[model samples]
Target: MIRAVGAAIGVVLAIVLASAAWVAVVSSGRVHDVADAPDAPVVIVLGSQVRDGKPMKFLSGRLDAAIEVYDSGRAQAILVSGDAHGRSGNEIAAMTEYLVDAGVDRDKIVGDDYGLDTFDTCARASDTFGVSKALIVSQGLHVSRAVALCRDAGIDAHGIDAECECNWLAVVRNYAREWLARPKAVLDLLSGRPPAVVTPPDGTLTAVSRG
Candidate 1:
C-alpha cells in the first residue's frame, strides 16, 4: 500500500509538471503586436526586477518593447506598475525611470508604486486608478496570466505580448517558474477577493490607507 501510494503521488506530480510544460509549449509561440485602432489609450509596461538601482537586462528589453508600442501611437499614457514595497527597495521608481530614458515623456508616465505583484497591479489599476481597460504588456507566458487576472478584476484589458523577441532561454526559465505559480493563482481566483492588498509604510496598497 505504501509503494502504491508513493507511485500515485509521483504520477500526480508528473502530471502537474507536464501540464505546465504543455502550457508553455503552446503559449510560448504567441505574442501580441501593436494594432492600435487609431485611438488606443494607455499602454502599461508591466514591471520586472531592477537590481542595484538599475534595469536588469531582461527588464530593459520589456521597457524597450513597451516604448515601441507607445511610439506606435497606440497609447497616449504609459503605466509602470511594480513593487514599491518597503523603503529599502522600489520597483515603480525604477520602472518609471526606464520609461523616461526610453524617450517616453515624463508627464505621460504614471507610476503604480503600489503594485506588488501581477494580481495586485491589475486590481489596483482598475479599482484605484479607475482604468477599465488598456493594453497590457508582458512576455507571452506571463502576459496571459496577467490578462487573466485583470479580466477577473473587471478590467477590459488587451494583452500585447512581448515574448517573441525575448531570449528563449530566459523565457524558458520563466515558464518553468509559472508551473508552480499557476496553481496558486487558480486558488487565489477561486477564493475570490483580490488576494488582500499589501501596504507599504508611506503609500497606497492597503484598503485602510495607512497614510
Candidate 2:
C-alpha cells in the first residue's frame, strides 16, 4: 500500500512538472519588453484584485505596461478584461477608470466584465470581441500561462511582463501557484469547455478599430 501511494504521488508530481514545462515552452520567444512588443489591434489587460474601486498593485502594473504599449503606438486600443461581479470590487470598472486617468482615450478602451479567469478572458476576447491579434500584459509568473492559453484559444497572442514591486516571498508564492495553475489550464483546454459567459459580439472592438 505504501509503495502504491508513493508511485501515485510520483506520477502526480511528474504530470505537474510536465504541464508547467509545456506552458512555458508554448510561450517561449513570445514574451517581449515594451519596446520590442509587436504591433497589434489591442492590448489585453488581465484583471486582478481591486479595492474600493481602485486597482491593486499588480493590476496597476499591468495597466502601466498596457499604457506603455499604447503610447508606443504598438496597439490601437486597450481591452480591460475582468470580473464585474467579484466580491472584492468591480474589477472592470476599476481597470477602466485607471486607464482613463492615465490619458488613454475613453473610446479606445473596452471592458469585458465576464473575464472571470485567464482562459475566459482569452476565449472571450477571441469569440465575443472578435479580437484577432493582441498583446497580453501580466506579471512575470503569469505571462507564460496567459500567452499559452491565449494561443490555444486561437488568438495571435504575445505577452508583456508587467513590472511590480513585489517582495521575494510574494513572488515565490506566485510562481509556485503558477506551477499548479498550468496543469489546470491544460485540462481546461483539453476539455473544450466554452467560456462561462458568452454574448453576442459587442462591436466594441470594431469601433475601436475604426478609430
Candidate 3:
C-alpha cells in the first residue's frame, strides 16, 4: 500500500507539472512590444522588487517599457501595481518615482498599493480602477500570465515584455515560477476567488490625474 500510494502521488505531480507546461506553451507569444502591442487607454506596469527606494533592473526595465508605450501614444495613462504592505516598504512608490524621473508626467501615473500579485492587480484594474482594457508590462515569461489574469478579470489586455538582458537569473527564476503560476491561475479563476483588494470604480482616477 505504501508503494502504491507513493506511485500515485508521483503520477499526480507529473500530471500537474505537465499541465503547467502546456499552459506556458499556449500562453507564449501573447506578450508584445510597444510597436506591436494592441492599442489601449492604460498600461498596467506590473511591479517587481525594489531596493533602497529604487527599482531593481527587472522592475526598471518594466517601467522603461511602459514609459515608452506612453510616450509613443500607445497609452494615455499608467497604473503601477504592486505590493505595498508596510508603510516604509512600497514597490509602487519606487515604481512611481522611477517613471516620473524617467520623464513620464507625474499625473499620468496611478499607484495601486494593494496589488500584491498579478491577479490582484488585474482584478483591481477592472473592478476598482475601471480599466476596461490595458497593456501589461512585465518580463516575457511573466507577461503571458499577466495577460491571462487580466483577461480573466474582464479586462481586454495585452502584455509587453520588460525583461532585461542583464538579469539572466531573473529570466530563469521567473520561467520556473511561471510554470507553477500558470496552472494556479487557471484554478483560481475557476474557484472564483476574489482579489485581496477592491474599491468602487472611480472614473476620474482612471484618467490622468496629476498631468
Candidate 4:
C-alpha cells in the first residue's frame, strides 16, 4: 500500500512538472513588448477583478497597456473582455468607462461583457466579434496562457505583457494560480467547450460600442 501511494505521488509530481514545462515551451516568443508590436491592429484586454467599481491594480495595468497600444497606433481598436454583470458588478462597464476616461474614444472601444474567463474571451473574440487577429493584454505571469488559449480559438493571437504593480504576495499568488490554470487552459482548448454566452447570428449579441 505504501509503495502504491508513493507511485501515485510520483505520478502527480511528474504531471505538474510536465504541465509547467509545456507552458514554458509553447509560450516562448509568443508575447512581445507592446512598444515593439506596432502592427497589431486589435488588442484584447483580458479581465481581472474590480473592487467597488474600480479596477484592481493588475486590471489597471492591463487597461493602461491596452490604452498605450491604442494611442501608439499599435492597435486601432481595443476589446475589453470581462464579466458584464457578475457578483462584483459589471466588469465590462467599469473597463469601458476607465478606457473612455483615459482618452480612448468610446467608438473605438468594444466591450465583450460575456468574457467570463480567458477561454470564453478568446472563443468569443473570433466566433462572435469576428476578430481574426489580436494582441492580448495581461500581466506577464498570465499572458502565456492567454495567448495560448486565444490561438487555439482560431485567432492569430499574441500578447503584450502588462505593467504589473502587484505586491510580492500577490505576484506569488498569481504565479501559483497560473501554474494550475495553464493545464486547465490546454484542456479547455482540447475539449472545445462552448462559451458561457453565445452571440446570436442575427448580430444581436454584438460588441457594445459605447459610442
Models 1 onward score TM values of 0.75, 0.96, 0.86, 0.89
User: Ranking by lDDT, best first?
Assistant: 2, 4, 3, 1
Q: Write the residue-wise lDDT of candidate 2 on 13-57 in tens digits.
A: 998988888887889999988778898989999999999899988
Give the runs in model 4 whose Cα sits over 4 Å from its true position.
201-211
> Once model 3 is optimally superposed onto the true structure by TM-score, how far is the C-alpha of residue 175 displaced, in angstroms?
1.5
Candidate 4 lDDT tens digits, 1-211: 9999999989877776776677667667888777766466688999888889988899999999898888887777888899988787788988989999999988788888889999999888888887777899898668977877787778888889888889999999988988778767767767878998897532222343211
Estimate every model's Cα lDDT from 0 to 1.
Answer: 0.67, 0.91, 0.80, 0.81
Model 3 worst lDDT window (10 residues): 202-211
The list of candidate 2 runs beyond 4 A from truth reads none
Best-matching candidate per TM-score: 2
Off by over 4 Å in 3: 1-29, 86-88, 209-211
| lDDT of candidate 1 over 130-208, digit per residue (tens) | 6766777876567767767777778767677663455779778888877667656556666776635644332222221
Top candidate (lDDT): 2
Error of 4 at 33 (Å): 2.4
TM-score of 1: 0.75
Candidate 4 global lDDT: 0.81
Better of 1 and 4 by TM-score: 4
